[model samples]
Target: MFRRAFWFTAGAAAGVWATTKVNRQLKKLTPESLAAQAADKAIEAGHRLKDFALDVKSGMSQREDELNDALGLHQDPDLPANVTALPGPRRLRAIEQDQNDPTTQFSYNRNEDH
Candidate 1:
């Protein structure tokens, strides 16, 4: 029984050691693939930067052409139009005003009824 137990323990230890060794070997093969992937990413980034620069150049030229046209380097759209405003109190004068008509003040407070 003791011998059997010893063999089982030894087998488990060997398994553990072998697994660690295989993992280490696999790790050793990773750097070349990682370097290749990094190179691909760098190339992709370079192309994106080139496209962005071209888009910026195109936008700047369009704006410049529009400005030149507006400045009469080419034909412009319009210059001026007519405008008007509403007349208010500033255009008129306020005169004296009144409350109850003094002409019929005594006719208040009473009437011809019962």
Candidate 2:
């Protein structure tokens, strides 16, 4: 009788253990759990990508500074020695006027081609 009782207790314990293990696995495999896991991974990847972009930007700035120092471009704060001045607003307005003039030799009209 004692042996039978012992066997019964063992079987009940095994059944409970199996049921608990299966329930835990099922919970993990649910749609909500899967979506949450995917969301977490995507957020992690986004953070890593943002960090990489910031690092690249910092490296670019450092390299640009080093190049400026090597080329003696940092001597003037108002105007760099290596860079040329761009066309001002007056030059841009003159160029626009030229482009708009139909009598000009090099005038370009978008409507003319069509």
Candidate 3:
């Protein structure tokens, strides 16, 4: 098992060394024309993406405006209706008799003598 692991590690190190050497050679041999071509492709893709985004936003906004108009959300009609009658105020009345009559005596608790 140890022998296998050692050979495997050695093989991996050799492969990495070979890859680094190849990368250095390729970096030194790079042609300016290929780099320019890649840059041009990137710019063209950017313009296409920008156009797509603008079209999507414009279509969405147009649909939103149409819906708002159909719903009449921006319009106001006539005077505002009275909302005071919605929840009627409570009236005070004696359970046994009407409190407005002066003849009715008000009840008093015996504890009030303290």
Candidate 4:
């Protein structure tokens, strides 16, 4: 009789524990809970991305300063912004089309029969 009572008590406690565990798991799988978890993860990723961008910007600034020092391109108060000579589009040199000009001897005429 004592063994039967002990077994019954044990079975009731196990049932309660299993129900609580399943309920907690189900609550976590609900849509609102899932959305909240996803939002938390996205916020964490955004923070990491912002930190990475700041690090890249700092490194680029340092490299730019080093390159300027190496190339002796110190900014001068007396120099005009246009005088910095930053690379830009340039006009192509005009090709001489005259057949008689020796410099134009290699000019190809697509219409001429070989």
Candidate 5:
């Protein structure tokens, strides 16, 4: 009968479609495919993080420049235009001192008098 043949054809088509779908899913679940997918995602995340860091850095520098301009920090009115300020002598001496000296050792004892 024509009705029986039509049903048989439909059933066969359904079976083929299901088999193809299952096969595609199995291919995606394989170890190599899974690893590739994970690697792709990690790379995408890294690129996004890198872009965020660069944006932050640029914004910080732009804000710093704006603040400096607002505060008039670009030039000192008291100092001569030709002369630039240098670090203080006391700070330089402190930085030049030996860091390994025993007298400079830090103490954590709580009972010691000030």
Candidate 6:
């Protein structure tokens, strides 16, 4: 009777352990868990793409400088890097205070202004 009781207890314990393990595995395979994993992978891929784009832009700038050096196009090494050879687009019209407001009249004298 003691031996049978011991065997039954051991069997019950084994069943519980097996059930817990299977539950954990099933949770990992659930739709919500899978979706979360896929989302994480997608975000990682987007970050990699952004980093690759920045690398490409930097490489292009470096190559542009090298080409300019080979052609002897860079005249002054001391010149400010922010300066550009061409001017940017000009504004077409001056800003007005209000669209419905009538235009103000003004008179100017060249001699008085000077």
Best of the candidates, lDDT: 2
- Model 4, runs deviating above 4 Å: 78-114
Task: Assess candidate 2 and give its lDDT.
Answer: 0.75
Q: Whole-model lDDT, candidate 4?
A: 0.70
TM-scores of the candidates are 0.40, 0.59, 0.37, 0.60, 0.65, 0.51
Which residue pairs show backbone clashes in model 6?
none
The residue pairs in collision within model 1 are none
lDDT of each: 0.61, 0.75, 0.64, 0.70, 0.72, 0.68
Count of clashing pairs, candidate 5: 0
Q: Which portions of model 6 show Cα errors greater than 4 Å?
A: 1-17, 75-114
For model 2, the superposed segments whose C-alpha errors exceed 4 Å read 1-7, 79-114
The reply for model 3, stretches above 4 Å from the true place, is: 1-30, 75-114
> lDDT, candidate 4, residue 80?
45
Tell me how candidate 6 scores on lDDT: 0.68
- Tens-digit lDDT track for model 5 on 13-93? 999999999999999999999999999999999999999999999999799779878877564563345433332555334
User: Candidate 6 residues 12-111, lDDT tens each?
Assistant: 9999999999999999899999999999999999999999999999999899889877877764443345532322222112113223455753222223
| TM-score quality measure for candidate 5 | 0.65
State how far residue 26 of model 6 sits from its true place (Å).
0.9
**Candidate 4: pairs in clash:** none
Instruction: Give the range of the ten consecutive residues with the poorest summed lDDT in model 1.
Output: 90-99
Best-fitting candidate, scored by TM-score: 5
Question: Using TM-score as the measure, what is the rank order of every candidate, best first?
Answer: 5, 4, 2, 6, 1, 3
Model 1 earns a TM-score of 0.40
In model 6, how large is the Cα lDDT of residue 42?
100
Query: Of the pair 2 and 5, which is ahead by TM-score?
Result: 5
Which tens-of-lDDT digit does each residue in 1-114 have in candidate 3? 999999999999999999999998777567875687688999999999999999999999788768767876442332133211111122123413435676876443333334
State candidate 3's TM-score: 0.37
